[model samples]
Target: MQTFHLDAISQDRQTLAEPYHEFLRTRDMSAGVYHMEPGSHDPQGAHQEDVLFYVIRGAATLRVGDDELEVGAGSIVHVPARVAPRFVAVAEAIDVLVVFAPAESAPTIEVKYTA
Candidate 1:
């Protein structure tokens, strides 16, 4: 059995100086935690694998493609492959649990943020 504690994962990520940390990785999927401080810029670009984000805490405006939507705790968001995704105007520190289909070890598409 595999078990994880979110707090522990978050601590490890912080120790590594990364905003996102992957705790689980398999052939078909990977799960991680992404923490962002208030008013921080998202350093992510488009990925080749589909992604699912579960907002655990805090609030922010998420930009997917040309759409901007408000998101907060308990929100579930999905983004398809090769689409730009970003979190802007963060009002609080966000802790998002992220899932990527088919793992995220493969190459990704880098798209510069225009906004």
Candidate 2:
């Protein structure tokens, strides 16, 4: 029983491994909005929890293990637990809505460059 407004959360950008606005976190799942600048790439790594990336704006190439694809607005990508993924060759700055199931406590790797 919680709610969030994207416009409100996106207004303030923070500096970290990846600039994001974390809006929800519970025992079962967690969610956030991530903003990436053009030419910025995410660090290569994996997570213990399954993750979903919903592209809200712009375009980029996502590499999930041995596979790669061009993703843009309206695209949805899923990465299973323990599968390393990376975002590269960003044609345009992108906004993504990210979610993880079984809520990830922290990154398995030392550095994670995305939400």
Candidate 3:
């Protein structure tokens, strides 16, 4: 039984960008906590593996393909592999638990975001 706590993950002070403290990452999946301050947003990028973004606190907007949707606390957004989706932290210092799986085996795709 593997057990862990988010408190054990310390706040990142090295950079000005949103803090990302990786807890665990195996050959099959990866997990981490992302903290973004108010008006701050993470880059809209694409990856190869399928991803699930779970909102732990606050609200955000998710862009999947040509569609844009709003998500908040307790909300989960599942993104399919090979698809480029972007997530923006809209509310004050949103915290998100992101998980990526399949060990990044899929092919990468281009993602474009518009305001």
> TM-scores across all candidates?
0.90, 0.86, 0.77
The lDDT for every candidate, in the order shown, is 0.90, 0.81, 0.72
Ranking by TM-score: 1, 2, 3
Model 3 gets an lDDT of 0.72
Q: Which segments of candidate 3 are over 4 A away from where they belong?
A: 10-18, 104-109, 112-115
Ranking by lDDT: 1, 2, 3
lDDT of 3 by residue, 7-114 (tens): 555355224344766677789898777777777756646778888888888777777777789888998989887667766547656788888896544345676557
Candidate 3, residue 45: Cα displacement in angstroms equals: 1.1
TM-score of 3: 0.77
State the lDDT at 41 in candidate 1.
Answer: 90
> Ten consecutive residues with minimal summed lDDT in candidate 2?
106-115
lDDT of 3 at 49: 84
Query: For model 2, what is the C-alpha lDDT against the true structure?
Result: 0.81
lDDT of 1 at 34: 92
Taking the tens digit of each residue's C-alpha lDDT, what string does model 2 give over 61-82?
Answer: 9988777999999999989988
